[model samples]
Target: MSSVCVNQALTDDELRWVLTRLDSDKDKEVFGLVCKRWLHLQSTDRKKLAARAGPHMLRRLASRFTQIVELDLSQSISRSFYPGVTDSDLVVIAEGFKCLRVLNLHNCKGITDTGLASIGRCLSLLQFLDVSYCRKLSDKGLSAVAEGCHDLRTLHLAGCRFITDETLKSLAERCRTLEALGLQGCTNITDSGLAELVKGCRKIKTLDINKCSNVGDAGVSVVAEACASSLKTLKLLDCYKVGNESISSLAQFCKNLETLIIGGCRDISDESIILLADSCKDSLKNLRMDWCLNISDSSLSCILNQCKNLEALDVGCCEEVTDIAFQDLGSDNVLGLKVLKVSNCPKITVTGIGKLLEKCISLEYLDVRSLPHVTQVRCSEAGLEFPKSCKVNFSGSLTEPDVLL
Candidate 1:
């Protein structure tokens, strides 16, 4: 199901030319067949070229393959990807990738309501569409998709910032089969929008509202009351208006929750977060309380003691935690943890992080950047070794940006 081949045959300069030459589109077939190693590049490398490298490059990349089931031009793209981008751009992307099952155009700054209308044309086969972080996208764009993409299941418009209750209402009523919906950072959404969503999409499994500041207990209560049983993952990060009461209601109602992220809610107490984590310990796989200033060592310790299934934790900026908090979470218990990021926490030293390295044998990613000990930990003299597959970035707190966590 997976394969990785290193491009060792070409020098760095040669590889650069091959990728640059890929823009011409005509060289793609021969580019794909240049060697057996080049085949893997087709799947993984195409997106990189589309995002960080060049948007026009995707046209050449898209031309190489006969079938493109998914296309993600999400957070990474800095510009447009169409030959003649307009309000009609979404239609263009839709039509070109005719067989597209998934389309992601998050943060495409140039995209607007008109371009979004073009996306309705893609509705037949498009099941997943993420237009989040796109400041220009509005209800007109969403309405087109809702009316046309009858088969859509997941729609993420988080941070579109302009969408109101009308858009949410249309989506809920029209896309009855919708499952995962992320309306995070939509400043204008309120109880009206949320009520419509809850009433319409009873089957929604994941709801992400990381920073929709306007949503209050009224908006959240609808989800707690209606979508509680079916909810699997919920993200309420930085939603300052949502207090502990709302969080508690969510925990009590959404018993089947698997992943919960409530980072940056300053008003919510550490006690509430701890209670939620402890309550969902068995099923909670990923929990991020980053920048939750109220969460101290006591609450985090509670999480460690109760949440044995936790695999990824972000306790960044929790100044109260010390080495004692990690004492209970030795490597023996967290064998499945792949990412351990605790950047910017003051209490932990690189030496404290050694406890994790000593225990979590399957650890592949360790990021302790901005911790005080990044400069202190000796890479050569730790008497420890990283796995051949593991990657760790320890930016220093010192002038060198070195530290460990």
Candidate 2:
């Protein structure tokens, strides 16, 4: 007869939504006092209620939380807050989230090896884990992950400078199923460290060692030889120690390679790149030679002439490439080329870009930022009409961002 009793008798969907919308965990707890049925409803409604607020508010709602499929406590927690967060707090959380798959703890600067080890205890189903930018994590912590998690597919540790070659070598032995791994900016990872990873982790399809200054020709050669048949994507950006020989080795071995990024590898000349294009011309889907100062348009032109399967090309800051490079791609009947970045090349003008817009009609994104000739030359003199469908960000004519898409 009472209004409270009348409201309590509503449909399950309405009751669930109502209980979830009630703010404060204390208030959510209050619902249980109403009846056993209401207490049952609170159990299911609390997670949905926690999801309504943002990710950081979940810990407040659920104290005994565990068995999470994906845990992204990355932005909410930092490394400094680690080891001290309590094993009981986590064990209660991890017990329910036994199905935890993806864990992204990026920028958790306070988290030490102890807290990492605690989390690793419950990581049986974890697949993709990114602890990138977590500065405090060392070999001790990574050893825990490598030992605990079995089916890890992707592991990213970019900019985690504390991670040495030892951590990588250890992972190669334990995490055998690792398909995609990123060790970018791990400066201590040398040729020997890379050798262990190359020889031990044979199933790796994508490997990133960008800015790993210590990795030299020997390391690359080791990887090229060991994982030749398996490697499909390789990134060595800012790894200046390796020269033309390593590149050639990669070309010989990684024939099925679909993506190769060697940006900022100054020692690698145009010759090896051309050889790579000649050998694996049809297989390479994405090629990024950005900031490689020695590379000229001749090799690139040769690549464009032959490798018609190019999907994404980044020649940004390669000052040697002139309008000729763009011309080769322009109206050359090249199919499947969608994204192109030719920013900061002084020789390319609006005329070449204009002509190419018509040719690369399929292009969805084009960035030609800071091209002196393009910005300096008068639009009328260039004789190129800007197209509509493509989002072109140029130094001269492009001003607005496309909003419709």
Candidate 3:
């Protein structure tokens, strides 16, 4: 025991092996703190990072995590005072991490077209980019990305008000492999842009035009027709211009649609919704028709009867939906339903919701808030009858502990 003394240190590869075994980021950080060599190795091996975005912080990150593939520089509401990541910071990011694939600058108000252009010029391998709520970003910035990142797959430009049809045209011309595109709150984007987009980018699978007020049936119909086989998730929430024609087109052509959110699309009638339920019954899982004033028992009954695989159903604010819709619910109907939201339905009482709970044994979430006929006392009484795992929202406000379960 006194004769043998092993002074050999673990090799870099061995240290990396150990680093890979660590599950938590805290454990990895502790490993890095063991020595400068370990820190360097950890930094080099790091492929993803989420940190506060600033010129100095980004520069340091770029220098340390040269191999980073995913970078989240999303600004939180609490940190609004700090000046966010800017064009110069992006330049540093582009130069440092050439292989960067996913970049999320969500809510980074300081990021403008110049910063995005820098990313486009350098990060050609970039695939998924989320610039959601970056109000300063216009078509000019995104067009540069479309031209450069040919393999771009998922791009979320939600709340980028300045983004117009020009960006769509650019994307259609260049990013043919684009699959998921989020144009939510891009009010400037209309049917013309969508038509042009689907013409070239027919591989698009998930499209979210939620709150794109100008987008109507013409644009959505084009998307349904062009990406009919590929389209899976279509969210048109608050797209007032979207009517029965769009839903009909989707039901007719896009048979594989999985998640369809027509919430706030008042123009959607029971006929179109029933058609949608009938057409996409097999594939449709999550269906949301919140604020679709015309949807009644007919549409609800049709959905419950047809969409057996339905997991999440939200008919909130649907003025016409009543207890009659739940009358025919059987043990087979919506068996897999996990989330049921019938909030603000003036006609739906606790009885209707209770009937739904009985049928939806797998129900995990039940939102019965704002039901004029259903009081908190009734909800509390009904809460005991709900599924064991179910969480009920009796009151409209989430903060109200008395009415929530």
Candidate 4:
């Protein structure tokens, strides 16, 4: 008198077909525990696996799925029970998966140079590796990666403070095909490393050097000179020492530049904006200059007039930007503008914003937070109607800034 006999009597072929129809790994895993017949089918077909388990569990998973190609041991809020996997564990895991191409070890605190070295030696075909927030990894571990994984195209080493010029120099020489590199919070990086990177990694397109305080005009100039033709996106958030020289260099040389962020670079003035508006007008799509206190209405006007293709613009905390800037910003030439953030700019009012919204037919998001006069009630009082395509964000509303520094 056993209950739930829906699948107990089915033939092996019928059971395998039902297991194959399951789209999620979790469901298939639960079914695998139903019986030995289901376990064999589920394990053999699995090619991707995401686990919060320690090395022992990872080894068990590898043994079950012989064809596994992608593995993620990154931290997750939902799976807090998994202990941080260690170096010896990585050595074991690396040997288990010969076809592993992508491995994400974000915030795996126990992993160090030794663990990464093991991965590099075993997984030569690894193309994407993210070790962001792994505090224990240093140059020694990265050097091992550079020596072995020549096919790596995207690498994220954000928050790894011990990485220096030597690590970058080594990567530039070995990972020549690398297109994206994230070094956010690697404050020790300076001109020497960037110079070496520009010389060797000419094909690099996206680079994030946010919070690398030591990177100044000297390093940025080299990037602009060497990778200008290929570099499409550049992030220099919190690089306080960067000034007009680096801005000018980018404007003059970076012909294909699309997204540019210099948030927290207080040294940037109206001149840099005008230069950028003039040089990268045709190519520039997104521009961010948060905390650029020196820029005023003139700079905004210059950008609006020239960068007609801009889809996203952020000038938050630019206190000098007044209502006058919005007059030209609403013109038909900037029809492509979809997202605009003017938060913390004390000078903008209901009149200015209403006018801008009326003309920006394609605008979908508007952030006017912290401006006193541009509230929802005030816009209604002014008899202004926003386009159906646009979502107006007023003071104290739910809107978030398009870019955060």
Candidate 5:
């Protein structure tokens, strides 16, 4: 019986296919150094490139990967490096990578509106642009983008505090295909601007106005009502002025809403939660109300009873939540419940969490940190172990229970 050869040389296409399966960029880059042929193939096939190696490195990358589609300079230290890519570096990129679709310049503090204008002039095909935390950019730069990148779909202007209604109005008029907009921490934005944007861009699906304190119920309501049927994910974290009225409007109109995050909206209460659960019950998947001090057991009970498809729930720092909230949650109705974060709820005990776990069989992540009575040892002593699928986070300075004499 003849056996296949143990060491057969692979064709170039087969070799490239194997290399393409590598998950990390560093691993793939290492493979590129193996031989000139491998290096050429790797460079040609590379579509996404992340840089923190400064402007010179970016120029080198642009020369190598001519067909690059996405470039991220988030300065996140993916390779334990610093990002020195300034407006000059962006000019180099904008000049070279015209085919770019997604460009993330997160935390690139050196980039100014001048650089953004350059990007707007170039990269017409760009769809997703994230300049979050680029402090120097103002409405002037954003208007440039609106004028140039008419096809832009997803824009992240988070931390660009200088931007206001003008930018939103420009985006609304030009980028009609706009779908996702992230305005997190843009404190200057008010209701009028957001309302203008939503009215024109009714197709928007995801809107993150997290920490936009100036935006109140009147402005957000316009968005909820305009894009009601089309909106899917809405984040209003730390938007203090938003109250039950805006939430009710959202619940009533955004019938297709899937993810709703209103964390730190202190004014919101059970009325908002119940309205949301009742309106988007079937479609709701993730709901986060962290730091919402007014929420209680009644709200959780309402969610469990109505939003059967809910998977992720975070009611952390809600001091009012207690064991009573978990008692009815374990019913067969919420079988899909997987992640539950009740951390900082001082009133919850082991018994309550145990009851909750018993019902939420699908739960994989359980954060019960700061609870008084739910120590790891106590859990073990009680003959209760988080199943292989569950990971329970514990807090508090209490030592494990003392062994019996």
Candidate 6:
């Protein structure tokens, strides 16, 4: 047979099979450059897209990527030159993409309740949505989503200050399948709201209420009790109202808790930490207690001794934690500690950090910044002793300091 006839015999499905086997997006792009038919097939096969979103851009995207399931219109930093996605763009998205499952509108400041209402009415299959930092969103918008998107499993409304108890009530009533929720910086959500939410959403696994000042022990304790078996990751960073009471409740109920972040919770004392370490010894893998003023060597020692599977620990700014805490790292079970951050700890000296470097063979990241006794010269001299794969941060720099001649 002739070469032209053999090439013409290849069907669309065969071309698509070849496209799927391409190693990278670059290779696929090169394949698409062959002809207009290949380009159209690549566009139709695309399932995920991340690009700058505006009314015209979204229109173009909806026409090109007909089967897009995940659309990311998130902007890390908003620019004045590029207009943010607004309600009209969302209307276009809802009308065009009927099967959209994951929609990320992070930092889309122009979005409002009207835009979300459109999404709720159209995108019933939406399972994941992130509206973090969308200051204009309120309960009215999220309530619409809850009423429509019943299958929602993940929702992040971090920095949406207008969200209140009404939104949680709506979610509890409809979105009972919610597994992960991030309400960080939602200042208006108080204990009553959290209590209402956890009463129904008992299957929640990951919850982040970081900087929710109105949330205290009452709210967190309710979550710990209600979602005891399911809750795994909990972040209470900067929740000054939280104290040992919440920690005690978590220790008693949430045995599966894996990651706990209580940074800036000054009220957490050694007693509760020790109890928590003992109770969650087998499950706890990551613990961040930075700026917890009451944590001392006693609790630090208890954590190192108990949490055999601990992979990451951050006790930065715990003034009372001294070099004695690092002594426990020598244990065989504790050698698996991978990431340790003791930055700004005045009592931790070169001796303590050196001990950690020598003991933690699998350590990948070590942050010793702002330690008074860990000077650049000392770090330079001891740099060779650190794990070959580990990255050390000293005085805000990760590079190894040059030793003086």
Cα lDDT over the full model 6: 0.89
For candidate 1, give the lDDT of residue 156. Answer: 88
Alpha-carbon error at 263 in model 3, in Å?
Answer: 1.3
TM-score of each: 0.71, 0.78, 0.93, 0.88, 0.86, 0.93
lDDT (tens digit, per residue) of candidate 6 on 161-199: 999999999999999999999999999999999999987
Which candidate ranks first by lDDT, i.e. highest? 6
Off by over 4 Å in 1: 1-76, 80-84, 89-100, 107-111, 328-335, 349-358, 373-375, 378-390, 396-405
Please provide, for model 2 over 146-201, each residue's C-alpha lDDT reduced to its tens digit, 9 standing for 90 to 100: 88887888999988898888887778888888889898899999999978876568
Lowest-lDDT window of 10 residues in candidate 1? 396-405
Q: In candidate 3, what are the lDDT values of residues 52-137, reduced to their tens digit? A: 75677777888888899998888887866654788888888888889799998888888899998998899999999999888888
lDDT of each: 0.71, 0.74, 0.87, 0.85, 0.84, 0.89
Using TM-score as the yardstick, the better of models 3 and 4 is: 3
lDDT per residue for candidate 4 within 1-405, as digits (tens), equals 767675567877888788778887679889889777678877876778887666677788888888877888788645444437789879987899888888888877778899999988998988889998888889999989989999998899999999999988998889998888999999989999999987778888999999999999999999999887898889999899999899999999997889888989999999978998899989998888989989999989888878878888889899999989878653355457888889889899987887676657798888888887777788889988777877766745565544433
The weakest ten consecutive residues by lDDT in model 2 span: 47-56
The regions of model 2 sitting more than 4 angstroms off are 1-67, 76-96, 328-332, 396-405
Better of 4 and 6 by TM-score: 6
Q: Which pairs of residues collide in candidate 4?
A: none
Could you give candidate 1's per-residue lDDT for residues 216-291 as a string of tens digits? 7778878887888788887877787877877777767776777777777766776777767766777777777777
- For each of the candidates, give the backbone clash count: 13, 16, 0, 0, 0, 0
